[model samples]
Target: MANFEEYKNIWVYTEQRGGRLMPVALELLGEGYRLSRERGEGAKVCAVLVGSEIGYLAEELYAYGADMVYQMDHPLLKNYTTDGYTKVMTDAIKAYKPEIVLFGATHIGRDLAPRIAARLDTGLTADCTRLDINTGNYMKYLTDYTTASSSGLEANDGNKGLKQTRPAFGGNLMATIVTPNTRPQMATVRPGVMEKRERETGASGQLVKVKVELCQSDIQVEVLDVVKEAKELVSLTDADIICSGGRGLGNAEGFELIRRFADKVGGVVGASRAAVDSGWIDQSHQVGQTGTTVKPKIYFACGISGAIQHLAGMQTSDIIVAINKDPEAPMMQLADYAICGDLKKVIPELIQQWDEEEQQ
Candidate 1:
């Protein structure tokens, strides 16, 4: 068994691409900072920065709440290779043990985190929506968020275990997992779920440079060139306003109206899982538990019933406007502004009013 006592501080795999830090990395730092503060044992929030010539990004990580940064700079790591990154990260984890490690559930993070965990013989919880270090906070989360009865659960106030909560059974249930035996408890968090702290303009932190030992023989696949796809992809996470459609639209053609309304409001088009599964829209436009989780400033739900699974994804939006004929629908009940009218008629009227207001 590993000596859990030796591991200290929290580490975030600060993922970056093309010299730009990913938003998820900043968000994780925010969470790590909070966890470290709650743990209250001089546990610092640290960031692990890997890639060639990326040491310059360390300052930004510090401003975002990282107390320290582990810089791993290497030419072999300039472009991400599974073998190169995994080897360096595994080596670093073994050398400088951390109590907790976090990764964003992006494509690279999903691929990298599991490999490092396997190498270190540690446990990793993937796609976690929530994390807690304090026992009280964990218990409160279970009581408030999950449907499972917390009555039967035992509480241990002294347990400082990382409570990693993730959606299971197709977003129908939430499971909180812990790795008490592991030294560095690891988890991959989905983007847009956690809140990011405001950046401090000139904050500073300690920087540790990691030594990299890698050769060509370690990597089997060679990336010859990266081809950029020339197509417009919907960026739901970055959108301030989102106009979404659901099964109540009745047919795929209903999305046409949704698109028009979205265009009018300068918002992006979003769709519920039902609409996407029914071939009403592309999977890229899906916003829900089985899809992308979003927290837009304004979320307009048109013809949606608002199932729990759907609510899990967009309930965090700043303001919700539900347009459904059924007044008793869950969306209408949850929405800040519920309109009990046919969306077909309501949408046009809303547009006309918006246009008239603009004309003035």
Candidate 2:
């Protein structure tokens, strides 16, 4: 069930939002750059971008590491409807026929990767933390957290070694997984999971503009209108600093303390899953493994306990400050600084201090 000759270069599904590129796209490109070079390949990193008249993005993708950009620009592709994207992406994969496909585990990526994998009839590993080529075993490994396995690679006289490492058991440890079976091996990676490489100064590549043939009857979803919601809910994902509350906050009043502190610091409000589940705060503000993954410059995890899932999202932040009465809480262990005391009193003091500092 395995054929080494059928494999080819690694590929990436470069995603665009409102005609603008998401940060995750660049991150994936950076990784592809590393993987391709290690295999003595010419960074054969290819990008498949499909949208209505959006081929203009190919140049930018090349600058970021795309050796070749396959673009399908069309009017029907303007909006991100599942049907149109799936069809176009499926076509791109069929035509180029890459050995591996990488999708960013972002808002759109999470939705798109699996469908493409299903269409290709290949095994897809979602949220992979790392990828590597093994020369000793000639296997490709996809691993996350402490979970690992091998691709059961074929013997290669022109190779190095393979060792894929990733977080396993909810960020507790790392395990490496190898595909011993499938071709065009696939993996979806989370944003901020990997380091970004230096950009190529004036890096240029080949670009192809292809128009896919389609009929009006082929389109099933009708776009009546685009009702854009103007009301912006406070989201921690985009916040610079988040003052989050959790079960340790005591009750509604404690959460209110967080809101006040957040306001004073000019940061958005946030909460742990415990606070959100208890209805003490709106679900939008939750930050944890099961909630929004945030990498704020500074995070004030007030009264929240740090579970692995919660840390999984926010652990990538520049700095973490946790507050809780229980010194032994998990949050305290992960924080850059921990304060033990009642948040009700501590938060008010912080707000006052912030105000005084601002006035000065």
Candidate 3:
């Protein structure tokens, strides 16, 4: 068994793009800080940044509660390559031996995390929506015998293990997976699921520079150029207010009204999976389990039945407004405000009233 006592601190993979840090990375640092406080008094929160000329970004990590920042900077590490990044990350993990590692479940993280887990021969929990230090009866299920022989958590208490929870069974159920025997319990959390802590007034952390042995031969693929996609579609994840349509809109034409409502509120348009599948809207506007998870400030659900899959995505929104003729619909019951009327009629009236108030 690996030595559990040797592992220390919670590490967050601080991902960056075009020299700027991704919001999800900072969000993970916030969560790591919270997890450190919850786990005990002495455990530190660390940020592992891998890129070219990103030494200056370490300050942002410290401000977001990172007690330490691990810098793996090199020209070869500028852009993300599965093989090159995986090699350096694996080497770092072997050397530092962190107790927990958090990655944002972005395209990069999803690809890199599994590779690291495979190299270390450890378990990885993906798309985690919740993370906490395990406690109570849940700890009973986590016994030394349940852990793999290669796991480093054999001598540790179950309470100290990271609890990684995600929606499973097609979003019908929630499951919490743990790596009790593993030295570094790894998880990839969805963006916006965790809140970023307030920046510290003048906090800073220790910066550790890691030099990895890498060469051109190690990279199997070559990048010719990076093409950026046009921003024609609405970004529901970053939208403060969202006006989403469902099957209730009846057809693709129904979205015309949803668009108007969204425009009136200065919000973006979202759609239920049913709407996207029905060809009423594009899949980019889909909001639910199979689509993007959003935590907007205000979410307006018009004509949606509020399936469990859909609710799993937007339930975290600060405020939910359900507009459905069916008073007993799940969204209606769960919404902060429910309007038991046809959205076709109600939406126009709402817009008209807002316009009138604005004119006055």
Top-lDDT structure, candidate number:
1
lDDT of 3 at 320: 99
Q: Compare the candidates by TM-score and give the number of the best one.
A: 1
As for model 1, its CA RMSD to the true structure in angstroms is 2.5
Q: What does candidate 3's lDDT look like per residue over 1-360, in tens digits?
A: 678899888999999987899999999999999888877749999999998899999998999999999999989988889999999999999999999989999989999999999989888999998886846423443442124232344334556777787887656477889897777889999987788999886788799999878998999989777777775677888999999999999999999999999999899999999999999898889998878899899999999999989998898789999999999999998899999998999999988897999999
Residues 138-177 of candidate 1 have per-residue lDDT tens digits of 7777778666666754566678889899877666467889
The residue pairs that clash in candidate 1, if any, are none
Using lDDT as the measure, what is the rank order of every candidate, best first?
1, 3, 2
Show how many residue pairs clash in every candidate, following the order shown.
0, 38, 0
Give model 2 RMSD, 1 decimal.
Answer: 4.5
Could you list the CA RMSD of all candidates, in the order they appear? 2.5, 4.5, 5.4
- The 10 consecutive residues of candidate 3 with the worst lDDT sum are 144-153
Instruction: Point out where model 1 deviates above 4 Å.
Output: 143-156, 230-233, 250-252, 325-341, 357-360
Query: How do the residues 291-310 of candidate 2 rate in per-residue lDDT, one tens digit apiece?
Result: 66688899998888887767
